[model samples]
Target: MGEVRVVAVDVGSVRTGSFAWAAVDVPAGGPGLCGYGSDPASAVASAAEALAAGRRAVLALEAPMSVPVPQEWEQLGKGRAGEGNRAWSASAGAGALGTGLVQGAWMLSELGRAVPGLTVTTQAGRWTGGDARLLLVEAFVSGAGKPVATVLGQHAADAEAAARAVADRLGGEAGTDVVCAPHRAFNLLAAQAMWAGLEIGADELETDVLVVRARPVST
Candidate 1:
């Protein structure tokens, strides 16, 4: 299989206008962070242009890309499965999700408008197919007890952390749906994009908001 570039964004408050991001050119390799910056729109536009020029990539957002609802619950008021105590509706997760809904949707819409026939998906097969496509995934940097250290500064470190996590995951199972959600699900971001005049081509059992975390370390 060919290499898929990974671009991870550590989203900040929309009001504060603070953001950070990291790009890993060869995720399967050392998965080294090749790029870092605070300009999200420029990074997104660049990725879109790269896709238009025939390059496969993954846009990992360090935010709640999808909201999970309990099967019998009347409303989405809890965290997703496997998220433990770090509820998506609480604290940082809640804020990020709110921002992600807008930022992710805007990015998707811009990509759709910039690329004539771009295919965005959560599936690895289609994303890494012969043609160029963008795969979207949620990145979980820290939660519960294991808080991510701000060694390289909070937002920047978060972006790098997300890139590293996703890269390592991809290294182990390149073809597996590591971060692609199972079952056909509805994503608010995708819906928002559709409302913004972007037609997103996604599979029935797929949504562009599967979560990716660092593989658990052996005790």
Candidate 2:
């Protein structure tokens, strides 16, 4: 594929929640909302229509990469080998791990089968923060100069934030790593996934949010 469509998805395992967004028509100014929904499958469908299969694209998922069952997360505790995040214990918890293995793994598998050539990566590696909420707020205000969750909701904001992270990483900083105090992973995922596609949003073309300077965030 010549171009790349940046798609970020926040999937909920079970009733938690799931949402998606595609930074389509990036570069003019800001990108529009292509895949915006609660259902992972449906959200991808929406994004698929808005995305061009001809171009190379990647899907960033803030979910667990793999989990055998719901209770497995609790047993995992803090982490085992490469399964947990030292920066924050959230990645070791049962809830986070559960969703990752159950919902996250399922989504990754499903998306791979459904979308041809779509690269999906889990955000649960050593690249996330202890407080997802705090990181999200920083990403929103720093990028847009305001609290975006009110308008986009937590789910959409999460998806948007991930998309922005991906965009910033693939732009020019792909060669470097985004690390903060305490040796956290931060925006490492974006940089690590540089081989995949990530682009800037446009203004001339219509999108959900106007282009606001969004960059890699880690703290």
Steric clashes per prediction: 0, 14
- Per-model TM-score, in order, reads 0.78, 0.49
Q: What's the CA RMSD for each of the models?
A: 3.8, 12.4
lDDT of 2 by residue, 103-184 (tens): 4334444544555455423232211222110011111213232225736576667767666665555444332222222222
Model 2 ranges off by over 4 Å? 13-32, 46-52, 64-88, 91-94, 115-147, 175-219
> Considering every candidate listed, which one attains the maximal lDDT?
1
Model 1 ranges with Cα > 4 A deviation: 14-17, 129-132, 144-152, 174-185, 196-199, 202-208, 215-219
TM-score of 2: 0.49
lDDT of 2: 0.38
